[model samples]
Target: MIPTLILLGLVFGRWWRSSLMAAAVGWPVVLVATDVMSIEVGLLGASALATMNAAVGVVVHQMILRMTRQLRPAGSSRSGA
Candidate 1:
């Protein structure tokens, strides 16, 4: 789930190649930090959770982008204040 959130943030928030590179870099860090190789595999439900997490990430990022654009000060002006 967390990974997919990162993936969507990378995809929707950044460029495509950056997204891919982030996944490539992040996965290994997670793998090494967690060290799950010694455990047996049984986390099959992760795919479903990942999907939801990604959706949430995309939505939140899109909203933030939209809000930032809307909040930007209109036109250029001198800062004589």
Candidate 2:
């Protein structure tokens, strides 16, 4: 649930790569907290969390790349020379 929400936030914010990097850090923190707090039955394990982040990150990153266009290196032509 937390990962999903984070991913959603990333998609909505159009900051997918950053979000996934955030998630890569975020998910493990979540799992560790769960264990420390004795919480159980979460939506996903660590691997799932990473995969989800990657999948959503790809979509989100592409959209971000499309939307912002500022991410491209300055003065680099898109067309192959």
Measured against the true structure, the TM-scores of the candidates, in listed sequence, are 0.42, 0.41
Q: All models: lDDT?
A: 0.53, 0.60
Clashing pairs in 2: none
Per residue, candidate 2 scores C-alpha lDDT tens digits across 10-66 of 564465555566666666676677774234445346535664656664676577777
TM-score of 1: 0.42
Q: Which residue pairs show collisions in model 1? A: none
Q: What is the lDDT of residue 48 in candidate 2?
A: 59
Superposed model 1: Cα runs more than 4 Å off: 1-45, 76-81
